[model samples]
Target: SVILFLNKVVISQVICKALLVPINPLFVCSRHIRNRYKRISASKMESATEPGESVAGKSTAMTAGQKKEDRMKRFRELHLKRNEARKLNHQEMVEEDKRLKLPSNWEAKKARMEWELQEGEKKNDCLARGEDYERVKLLEVSAEDAERWERKKKKKNPDPGFSGYAEAQLRQYHRLTKQIRPDMEEYEKQREACGEDFHPTTNSLIHGTHVPSKQGIDRMVEDVSEKQIEKRAKYSRRRAYNDDADIDYINERNAKFNKKAERFYGKYTAEIKQNLERGTAV
Candidate 1:
């Protein structure tokens, strides 16, 4: 009866809103109508509430208690729910187990095993074929292909990436080498042109068939030896510039000799004065 009433009310609202105008719009207070509908909805919602039951039929029970009767009841409910869930989970896991397990039929199982065994071999063969293809492709590069690649590369970078300074440096090096080549070649030619007769002696002087005359050689040798001896003698005679002992000894000896000579002169002069006075008196 209540459901029939609700259905009729919904239908009337939907149909009458567009077709029938309200005799007295003030009689239908929108706020009062909404409040009435809200109260009805709340009552329905409260009456519909049940323990451990949701709109989706899932249980949300709180079975915690100390009484033996409540505990047993809770255990029974929990065991029932667990059994139901286990049944459904077992059904799901059965498919997964089938996926994991070998087939039961011997021939089909043997075929699957063989396929699994040869899977690695087939992959290896494919890999080997791919490697062979790569090797063949690498070996198949012809001179024309190389030349084409070279042309592409040459076209890509025909210009050297050197700045003016770098180019000038390279040009300078080339010019220097060009200038040095003649000198090096001339040196080599001179070295080659000279025979044993123009070779240097042990003294690093050019002493060969074209050397100075024997007389000149002997005079030069004698002069050099004499100069070396004189240099040694001068070095041996040389004393440190700050040597003071010899200077001090010579100064003391000169002082003593000067004092002795002055005394002898003074004594003789005294004797001459006395003798001259004596002769005058006579």
Candidate 2:
């Protein structure tokens, strides 16, 4: 009986030790992992809170009154900058206007005359060399076609009667005379000043007409050819005068925008000041 009781007690003790040994280490490791995760989370929370606290403190230090004053100061500074920029741009535009003279209508007319003279010379050369008239014919056809197209495109109602024809003739005459009137007047004045003593060269005279010498004619031709070549090169490469006009237009547009901006800035500043005085500024 005593031997059986001792065996039973020892068996029970061995069973309890086998179950607890496996479970004890697993529980201890799980608790240690949980504690490590808690520490990491606590550190992250502290790091995030520190910056937030500092920002809150700073914001609290800056009162509503101080913020309003700062905004007003910034508004004034912005207007001052706008005014300065406008003034500087105006000064620059004034200097540019002084430096670059815009081409007038008279200058454009002169250029047109020079171009026409060159074209006349080309046509004369072609005819003098006895070249085929195909190119000339083509040019004439093209000009006629362009004129026809223009006439067709612009449908102007013509007036019936001699009044319309007379008005058109008068308009054409005025247009032709506009440029030469000043030149003709100047020449008349010069002739009058010279008086009756001035003897104009005539083809039929007692000493005969003084014709240009061969050397003088050649020199004149050379000068004319050089001028034609220069003009051809200038127009063929690019219209530099047109580019100048475009630059002037862009500068003027920019100056106008700057002026508008200055006006807007002034108006905005005035409104803000009025609001502040009434204690209604945001």
Name the best candidate (by lDDT): 2
* Lowest lDDT 10-residue stretch of candidate 2: 239-248
Runs with alpha carbons beyond 4 Å of true place in candidate 1: 1-140, 152-157, 160-162, 171-188, 194-282
lDDT of 2: 0.66
Expressed as tens digits, the lDDT of each residue in 94-206 for candidate 1 is 97787678555856878889997776675677587776544555576898998999889988943332234666578657754674324465556656766543466675544
lDDT of 2 by residue, 1-282 (tens): 346545655655577687763334455456556877899899999998999999988887777769899999999999999999999999999978965776557568889999989878877888999975567646667767978878977756532223345676786577546734244665676567556534645542434434445865886587568865786478634212333332313575674564455445867677886798799999
Q: Which stretches of candidate 2 lie over 4 Å from their true place?
A: 1-57, 62-282
Query: What's the lDDT for residue 24 in model 1?
Result: 39
- Report the lDDT of model 1 for residue 95: 78
The estimated TM-scores of all candidates read: 0.15, 0.19
Clashes of 2: 0
